[model samples]
Target: MKLSGIFSDGMVLQRNAQVILRGQCSVGGQTVQVVFREVITCTDADPSGNWEVQLEELAPGGPDELVITAGEEKLVLRDVLVGDVWVLAGQSNMELPVRRTLDRLAEEVRGLDLPMIRQFVVPQSYDFHGPRENLDSGAWVPATPEGLLGFSAAGFFFAKKIYERYGVPIGLIQTAVGGTPIEAWISEPTLRRIGGYEATLEQCKDDAYVQSTKQRDEDRNGQWYARLNEADTGLREGWHQAEGEAAGWSEFEVPGSWAGSELESLRGAVWFRKEIDVPVKMTVGEVQLALGTIVDADDTYVNGVLVGNTGYMYPPRRYTVPQGVLKPGKNTLAVRVITTHNTGSFVRDMPYKLKAGGQELDLRGPWKYRVGAVTEALEPQTFFHYMPAGNFNGMIAPLRRFPIAGVLWYQGESNTGQPAGYADRFQAMIQDWRETWGIGEFPVIAVQLANFGPEGEQYTDWAELREEQRKGLAVPRSALATAIDLGEYNDLHPQDKKTLGERLALSARRLAYGETELVASGPMFARMERQGDALRLHFTEVGGGLTTRDGNALQGFSVYGPDGTFVPAQAFIDGDTVVVRQEQLNPPVHVRYAWSNNPAKANLYNREGLAALPFTTEA
Candidate 1:
C-alpha cells in the first residue's frame, strides 16, 4: 500500500510525547503491525484501510526505525530523529523570502546551510469545511540556498537560531497563505465556537458570492491586458506619428504616483513620457534609472527601446538601463503603468532618479502623460476561499504522523479589526492544534504586531489587537516577542525580519531549551497601584531593572480619568515601576503603554534591550 505524503523515512517526531503513527493500508487488511525500537504494537485497520497507533512516550535520543507490516508487504521507515518541531503560520510578511530582502541571496543561503534545519511548505488551499485529512502536495527539504529561498524568511531565520543553540534537528511546518484572514486558516468548529466568524462563514455560503465578487476583478485584469495589446499594435502601425509637427511633451518624475496630481481615483494603464536633453560632453556608458515603486506594474522604455519593468507593487524602484540605451542628443523616456486597485502614484519616499557614468540625473519633476485606457474599477475577490479545516486538511493533517518540536507563529495582522474576540480565537486555535498533535503544552512563541502606520492621539484597532496578543501569554507555555520598535510607518511588511526571527529564538531558548538565566521577554504590566496624586504601574519579568530603549524620555503612556478620557501623562521610571502622573487628574483610573497606532517615542524597555510589551491597565 502507498503511504501518505507526510510519511517519509528520514522524519523527526516530537520527543518524549505521545507519538501517533497513522497511515493507509490496502482494503480488507485485517491487522497492521507498527514496530519502533524493540516494541511492536498491532492494531486493526479500519474499513477504508485507515489505521492509527499511539506509541508510548520514549526518550529524546533516537536514530529509530519504524516498520509497518500489513498483509504480505513490509514497509521500512529509517533514519528518523527525535527532536522538537514547530509550525510557522502567517500572511505575506511571514511568507516573504530572504532573497527579496537582501540582494545577496547566494551568500545568505551559504551561511544558512544547516542539515538539522528542515522545512515543509504546506500547499495553499481553502475550503469552508473543517480541517482536511491530507494536503495536496509538500515534502520536507533541508535548509540549503536553493531550498531556503522558498521557505518563510522569518521561520527559516528563527529555526536556524534555535538549531544552532539547542543542537537539535528543527522541523518547520509552514502553513501560511498571503492576504488571508485569520478565520480562513482556523478550523470551522473553532470559528463557530468564537463569535463573528459565523457571519463571515455565511457570507462564504452565498450563492451569487463568487460571481458577483469576481466580476470587477475580471474586468480590471481584462482591460489591462487589452490595453497592453493595443499599445503594442499602435507602436507597430505608426499610429503615434505626427502628421506635420509633433507637440513637445514635458518631463515629470518617472517613478512616483500620479494619484494626488492630474489623475483622480483612476486605475489601469497610463502612459507617461519625459524628454531629457543629453549633454554634449556626457559620455554615457551605463545608465541607472530609479523609478521608485509603481502602484501595480510598469514597463519603461528609453529612446523607443525597452529598458526595464516591474510586474507588481511592493518592490523597491531600482531598474538598470544597459550601457548602450542612451543617445547623445534628445532622448524620450516613456513608461506604461498598469494599476488594478488603489491610486496610480509611485509610492513616496522612494528613489526616483537616473544616473549615467558618475553623473546623477534628478528625475523628480513634472512629466507629460496621456491615458492609455480607462478600465473598470478593480473589485476585491476571494480567489482562495478561507474556511475552517481547509488549511488543516490541506496543510497540516498529513503531517500528523511526522514528529515536531513546537510552534512559532508570526501572524495576527488579518484579524486586527476584531481585537475584542481575537484572544479567545487564538487560544482556541492553539488548543485545537495541541489536541490534534496530542502534545502537552508544547512551547509556542509568537511575534506581537509591530508598530505601524502614523501615530495618532486617538485609539486604534491595531493597538487593541496587539494588546490581545499580549493577553495570549496567559495561556500555558506561550511567549510573545515584542516588535513595537521594529516596524516601519510606511511599510506594513517591514524588511527587518532578522530581528523578529532572533527574538523568537530567544523566547524558545528560555522556554524550551531550559535557559533559566536568559531573559526571554520584555517587562509585562503586572499590577497597578494608586498613590497620592499619581498612579504607580508595576511590571513582571523586570529583568534587572526597567530602562528606556532610547536616551530620550519615555512616551506612549496615557492616563485616563473617571470620565474615560485619556490624556498624555508625564511618565518616569521609578526603579522597576513606571510612575504616571497627570495634573488634570488627581488620581488616575487607567493607564496605557504603547497604546497608539505608532508611538513615536515609546521607549519603554528592560535593561536587556528588549522593548516592553504593550498593555492596558483597564482590567
Candidate 2:
C-alpha cells in the first residue's frame, strides 16, 4: 500500500471539513485502514489499485500523525496540521518568490518564525494529453527563513497576515509558472467551449510537430549565439579588461533603452564601461553593487574580473563585490549585454549604485559603449508549457482532491495581448475550478492588472485588461483588489507586494472569514449622471467616504462629448461623489478615470488609502 504524495509529513488537512485520504494498494479488494486522532476509517482497493477513505470534520489544531495500513504495508505521516489551505495560482507575478521582494519587504520578514505557515510548491510541469492523477514531485515545507525564500512573495505575505489574525496554521499550494497566459490554466473542455484556442491546442497535441518546433528553436538559437561569439571583436581584443583604452566608443546614457538611438535597430552584443573613484574608508569591506534590471542577458565585470551575471531580465541585478575587487582610487566597471529578443535596455527608476559601510556611489550617468557584434534578432521559441490547458492538466488537476479554503490569483500580464475576451475567460476559469472541485463558490480574490508601460504612453490594451479583470467581480463571492497604484511604471513585477497582499487579505477577511464589518475594497464606479453642463460620477465601497491619495486637485478624469473627442477634465471630490467638467466642450456624454496605461497622476483614493478602481462609463 502507498499513499498519494500529497498525504505526507508536514502537510495540512483542511480544518472543519470532511477531507479525503487517498492511496493505492497492490492487492485488489484489500482493505486499507487509516487512523487519526483515535478515529479509524477503512476502504477496499479496487481492481485498479486505487483506494479512498473520507474522514469526519476535523477542527483546527495539530502537529499530529496519520497512520495508514493495508496488509503488511504501513505508512505513517507525521507533523501534519489541521487548518486553512489556500491555492496560490497565476503567472510570473504569482510565481515570483520572496527572494525577489527582499529589497522591499526585508524588514517585515527579517525575524519571522511562523512555522505554522507552510507551503507546498508544486513542481512545474505540463501535459497535452489529459489530467494527471498524481504529481511527479512535491513536498510540504514550513515557513522557515530559508524555506520562505522560495515561497511566493504575494502568497507569503497573505499567509502571514491570515496566520497572525486567526492564529490558524496556513497551508499554501503554489502552482504557478512564469510567462503563462490565463488560457493555459483553464481545462481543455472549458477552452474548447470558449473557442479561439482550438487550433493552438490541436497543434500542441501532435508529438512530431512539438518535437520539430523545439528542435528548430534549439538550432536557430545555437547558430545565432555561435555566430555572435565568433564575430565579436570585443572578446578578441579583451574589451572587458581595464587594460584596454576602449577607443572608438561613443557616449550613451545609462538606465535607458537603446530605442531611438544609433543602436535602436541593432540586435547583438554591446559592451559598456564606466569609471568610478572610491574612498579608502568605503573600500574596507565587501561592497554591494546594484545594476537595477537589464533586458535579455548581461555579464558584468568589476575592475578586470567577472563579478556577476544574469541570464534574461525581470530580476533585479544585485551582486556582492569582494573586498579585494575595489581599490582606494579609480576603479573600472564593465558590462557586456546580449540582446536575444526585443529591445536591449537598462530599465529606469531603479537603483543603480554601489553601497558600502553606509556610503553610496551613484552609478547612473553617461557611459562609453561600443558595438561588439551585430546579428539578426533571435527567433522566438515555442513554449509548449504555455499551451492552453497544458498547465492545468499537469499541475492543477492533481490537486483537485485536496480541499482549499480559497484561491489567490495574480495573473493577467500574459493575457494583455488580447484583453477583450479576458472577462469571459477569467469568469469561466473561476466557474470551471469551482465545478471541478465540487465546492460551493469559494471566495476568489483576484488582483487586477497593475499599472505598467512607460509614462505618458497610453497603453489602451493594459487598461482594457484591467477593466476586464474588474468585471470578474460580477461573479458571486469574488473580490477584486485594485493594484493600479501599486505597480511600477518600468517593471512588470512590482516590488510592493506587501500592500497588495494586505489588500487581498482584506477581501479574504470579508468574503472567506465572514468579517462583513471590514472594508474590503476601494471605490467602485456605481453610476454616472449628467447634471446640467457637468457630469456627476457616483461610486460604491467608499470606505470612510471618498478622498485623494495626494492632497491636491482631482486628476486622471477625462470627458468626451457627442463628437467623440476626449479631453482632460477638471474633477473634484464632493462627499462620496466626484464631479467632472470640461469648460471648453459641449455637455459631456461619456467619462473615464485613470484610463491610461501608466496613469501617474491618478490619485483618487478613499479615506482608507485604497486607490479607486479604473473605469469608463461607455456602453
Candidate 3:
C-alpha cells in the first residue's frame, strides 16, 4: 500500500474537518484499514488498485501516530499533528524563496524557530490529459533552522505570524511557478464555462497535438540555449587578458547603449575590453566587480578568466573575483554582451566599479569595443507551461482532498496585457477552487498587482489589472491585500516579502479567522458624489478615520471632466472620506486615486497604516 506523500510523517491534518485518506495498492482486491486515535475507517481496493477511507472530523491538537493495514502489508506514519492548512498559489512573487530574502530576513530565519510550520512545494509540471492523481514529488518539511531557506518567504512569514499568534501547527501547500498567468491555474471545465478559450481547449484536448507541441518547445528551447552557449566568446577565447587581441578594436564609451556608437541598430554579440592596473595592496580583503546592468544578456571576464554571467537582463551584475584571481599588475576586464534583438549596452545610473580593501576602482570610461556575428531576432519560445488548466491538472488536482484553512494568492501581472476578461475569469477560478476542494465558501486573500515600471505613466494595463483583481471581491468571502507602496519600480519580484506576508496574514485574521476588530484590508473607494464644483469620495475600511502613511498631504488624486482630460487635484480629509477639487472642472465626471503603473508618492492611507486601493470613480 502506498499513500500520498502528504499523509507522511511530520504532516499536519486540517482541524475540525473530515479527513479523507486515499492511495493506491496491489491490483488484487483487498481491504485497507486506517486507524487514528479512537477512530477507525476501512475501504477495499478496486481491481484497478484505487482505495480511500473517509475518516471522521478531527479537532485541533495532536502529536499522535497513524497506522494503516492493507492485506499483509502495513504502513505507519509518525509525528502527525492537527492544525490549520493554507494553499499558497501564484507566480514569481509567490514562488520567491526564503533565501532570496535572506539579506533582509537572515536574522529572522536564524532566530525564529517554530517546528509547527511545515510546507510541501509541488514540483513544476503540466498536463492536458486530465487531472493528475499524484504529485511529481514532494515531502513535508518542518521549519528547522536550516530548512527555512527552502520555504517560500511569503508563505513562511505568513505561517510564522499566524503560528506565533494562535499557536497552531501551520501546513502550507506551495503550488506556484514563476512567469505563469492566472489562466494556467484554472481548470478546463471552468474555462469552458466562462468561454473565449474554445480554440485553445480544442487544441488542448488532442493528446497527440499537445505532446508534439510540448516536445517541439523543449527541443527548440534546448537548441536556443545550446547555440547561445556555443556563441559565448568568453567561453572560447580568453579575451579578458591584456595579451589578447584588441589592437584592431575601436574605442567606445562604456555606460551607454551601442546605438550611440558607430555600430548603431545592431543585434547579437558586442565584445568590450578594458585594461587596468591593480595594486596588490588593494586586492587584499573582500573584492567585488560590479558591472552595473546589461541589456539582454552578458558574460564578463577578468584577467583572461570568466568572472560571472547573467542569463538575462534586469539583475544587476555583481560578481566575486575570488581571492587570487587578481594579481599586482595590468589586468584586463572583458565583457561579451549578447542581444537577441535591439541595441546591447550597459545601463546608466548603476554601479560600475571594482571594490577591494575598502577602495573603489571606477570602471566607467572609454573601452575598446568590436561587433561579433549579428542575427535577426529569435522567435519567442512557446510557453506550454502557461497553457490553460495544465498547471492545475498537474499541480493542484492531487491535493484537492486535503482540507485547508484558506488560500493566499499573489498573481495577475501576466494577465495585465488582457484585462478585459480577467475579472470574470478570476471569479470563476475562485469558485472552481472552492468547489473542487469540497470546502464550502473558503476565504481567498488575493494580493493586488503591485506598482511597477514607469511611474506616473498616463496609460498602462497595470491599473486595469488591479481593478480586475479588486472585482474578484464580488464573489463571496474574497479579499484584496494592497501593495501599491511596496513595489520596486524595476523589479517584478519585490524583495519586501515580509510586508506582503504580514498583509496577507491580516486578511486571514479577518476573512478566515473571523476577527472583526482586526483591520484586515486597505480602504476601498466605496462611492463618489458631486458636491458643487468638487467631488467627495467615500471609502470603506477606514479604521480610526483616514490618514496619510507619510503624514503628508494627500497625493495621487486626479479629477477629470466630461472631455476625458485629467488634471492633478488637491485633496483633503473629510471624516473617513476624501474631497477632491480642480479649478477647471466645475462638475467633475470622474476621480482617480493612485491609478498608474507606479504611484511612487501616493500617500493616502488609513490610521491603521494600510494604503488605499487604487481606483477610478466612473462618471
TM-score to native of every candidate shown: 0.83, 0.96, 0.90
CA deviation > 4 Å runs, candidate 2: 280-286, 327-330
Task: Indicate which candidate wins on TM-score.
Answer: 2
RMSD of each: 4.8, 1.9, 3.1
Residue 288 lDDT (model 1): 73
Q: Write the per-residue lDDT of candidate 3 for residues 70-178, one digit (tens) a residue.
A: 8888888888888999999988888888876654566777766678898988788888878888764677888887778888899998998899899888999899987
Residue range 1-619, candidate 1, lDDT tens digits: 5565555655666667777777778765579998888899999988988888887776655567989998986899877666677888777777877665553233555666665677777777665544566655567777775677777778887888877776777777787776665656566666677756576666655647745766766786676677665655334532233221224443355446565666657766677766677764443676777776777788888776777788777766566777666777777777777777777776666566777767766776777766666666565555644554456555665565555667887778877777787777777778877777665677888889888887674657889999888888778889999888888776677767777888999998888888978888889999999998898999988897899877778888899888889889999999889999999886689998988878768998898888899999976
Best candidate according to lDDT: 2
Q: Which pairs, if any, clash in model 2?
A: none
What would you estimate as the lDDT of candidate 1?
A: 0.74
lDDT of 2 at 180: 92
Segments in model 1 whose C-alpha atoms lie over 4 Å from true places = 8-12, 25-82, 103-110, 199-220, 223-250, 273-292, 300-312, 315-334, 351-369, 387-389, 456-459
Clashes of 2: 0
- Stretches of candidate 3 above 4 Å error? 37-40, 61-64, 107-112, 218-236, 241-265, 272-294, 302-308, 314-333, 342-369
Candidate 2, residue 118: the lDDT equals 94
